[model samples]
Target: MEERTRAYLRGRFGDYYRRTELTPPPGANEREWGFIPWTSGPGTTMVRHRSLLDLGSIEDFLARKRPRHVYFSAGRYDEPSASSMSEKGWRSSDLVFDLDADHLPSVTLGEDSYAEMLAKCKDALLRLLDFLEDDFGFEDLTIVFSGGRGYHVHVRDAGIQGLEREARREVVDYVRGIGLDIDEIQTKEMRGNTPARVIEKDGGWGSRIHQRLTALSDDLKRMDNEEALGRLSEIEGVGDKTAKTILGAVSADQDVEGYTENEEVEINYEAISAGNIELGGVGMRKLIDAIAEETVSAENAPIDEPVTTDTNRLIRLPGSLHGGSGLAVRRIDRSDLADFDPLVDAVPETFVGHEISVEVTDGGTVELRGDSFTVEEGVHSVPEYLGVFLMARGRAEKGQE
Candidate 1:
């Protein structure tokens, strides 16, 4: 890491025990791990500024750092799947503030492009404002720069009260819309667990909308309740900013847990060409123009297990314990740091979705799904940082054991 980058991190984290890399835990050989978190693309999203910085205090940063975390990841860059966060299996309940697509950058070929990136970022802000109004039943939303690569849009009106991470994912997906893969992201930004904040910010409409939704409840007579429940669609105007509240007031209700399960998928290939690609019922995990990045061809990817290979694989994810921030590692161990690599790369033939389905029998059609891969590795070292979301909820309910 450059001095300036170190300084910037210091400015934000203020003297975190520094290590050059995250090595694997000693008892195990490193290659057995897979996934990396925190850095962005091996070549994309580099730390552009070089000024040394300081973060006075972590508590202050968390309360006022203004950057809301939405995802957690860790792993190596050298061997893409050799290690990752999910494999470590942890999670967190970050103050997830996702933005609309317009909020992202449209990096044109070579020129001083910060202006362009920020412009698109702002344009996405406007669209987000409208998005909260239409999909979320709110007329306002707040925007903040992530200090790093993206933007953080906060909707902290009382209406939401506060959402657990999994629920937040559903909200962001709803607000981001469908036709596009709204529920999944190829990289961490889509998950929003990275440390992010506004370069410049001021609170306004989003806050106002949030407050209204929070207080706007009614004591309806049974008949009135019946009537209101019948017109669930219009109650949104009564200032309900979230579907949770609106639906709670509605007649038909579904188990929030079952309805919002993470759609599971498995990606064995990575770095396929972009454009005109679709994954039937799922989204392409990370659709980069692989040819632009390297000479790795479709046939060059590793297939240790055939796409059609079959096995009674049983992955019993913590299903009963779901939807909570699992852990905030006090310090990333150094040996684990060696497992951390900044240059690992891989082509994901399939990136798994949230829903984990068991292949009932062998010899049935097992296909590779979703073309996803980190353009650069070592960005997110703890691959399963987001996997144990239940841990977060478990902590909160069980009182932080």
Candidate 2:
């Protein structure tokens, strides 16, 4: 960082420490806190056996060290040292979920790409939230925008505090939809002269399957018969004849019989027999498997599995600045999440009114607040927030004007 940038950051930290509310992790006195102070040459330094007595103590520490980044352990410890986990005598920990857009398929890192990637990340976070709340019944959750590429969900349910590594992995698997048996979730039944419809039961993964299918049905309805048939035929076991029959049945809103009251709705299987589509249970299984794959792919949130499973994970402290992004790690209220714009909302108020000149070293277009600007190899006067963000990214230098 340049001298001017460093000075600006230090000044911001001074204000932040005074104004920002800092909440120590549960069992804070027993957990280790890590800091990457501006004076620290390159890496973070872990401060152990050092407990903050109150918010004033936290502010005092920040004023003294002026760390570029702050983090605390997910796990509580008796020893609170980095030397050995076994010696630390680990206690209960929050179940942490890290959802990063970079982990999602086709995400690229650049200013031009950030908006789309952020949207993708928001979608993933919402899905994960649904899974956590509706499926797992977890109510005590904290959501934070990581101030860079993703969000974090911290589950602090008392009942889940004692969950072991394997149990944690099971929760991760459920969120990722890994090792889910499609057959167990969906069953196929034959109606006279109808296509074999995959019937989704109520509750569990069944609800998700139903949601996906309903969306798919709406999309399929928008397409012409031939288009619907073509898309359906792309599925592994769905032949042209079967696809046509299925499309016809779906288009006609044909309903299947034998489904219990508990079942949401039955897919019509009469289309298969009507079209003389001869296939065994294996073929039916394949079609259902295809639907399952589609549903999972569309709905599953991409999260760092290791982060969630690791018992001793250290998560970024909310309200601290992300060193790489120069943005505040913001704690988001559950109700405000849908409207929270990280790029705009996570910016420090200290950077709001000030404007700085910077020379773009790497060319790209970036949108800040609501305005978009094309960045190229030249000096530009921009909001202090943008200047700091560009400087942190190593894409811009302090411009000599």
The most accurate candidate by lDDT is 2
Report the Cα lDDT for residue 301, model 2.
Answer: 69
lDDT of 2 by residue, 1-401 (tens): 56666666667677766777677666777776667666524444554433344223666787667777788878887777546778878888899999988888647665427888988899899999989988889999999999888999999999988889999999988888899886566555565566544545466776676665556566655665556557678876677655544544433344322222233333443333222223333444445556677777777767899998888887898888887778899999999998999878988876788788888888787777767878888889988888878887778877764
Clash pairs of candidate 2?
193-270, 194-269, 194-270, 194-271, 194-272, 195-269, 195-270, 195-271, 195-272, 196-269
The weakest ten consecutive residues by lDDT in model 2 span 269-278
Q: Tell me the spans in candidate 1 whose CA falls farther than 4 Å from its real position.
A: 1-95, 100-112, 133-135, 138-142, 161-166, 179-401
- Taking all chains together, the TM-score of candidate 1 against the true structure is 0.25
Model 1 lDDT tens row, 1-401: 22333223223222122211222221122112211112422232321111112223223432233221321111112222323334432222112243322323343434523334444554554555544655466533433343222344434345553344455545544444322231222211111343321111112222222222222222222224334334322442322223223323122332222221122222111111111123211111111111111212111111112110111111111111111122221121223323321111110111123321111111211111122222121122212222122112221111111
Collision count for each candidate, in order: 100, 10
Evaluated at residue 234, the lDDT of candidate 2 is: 81
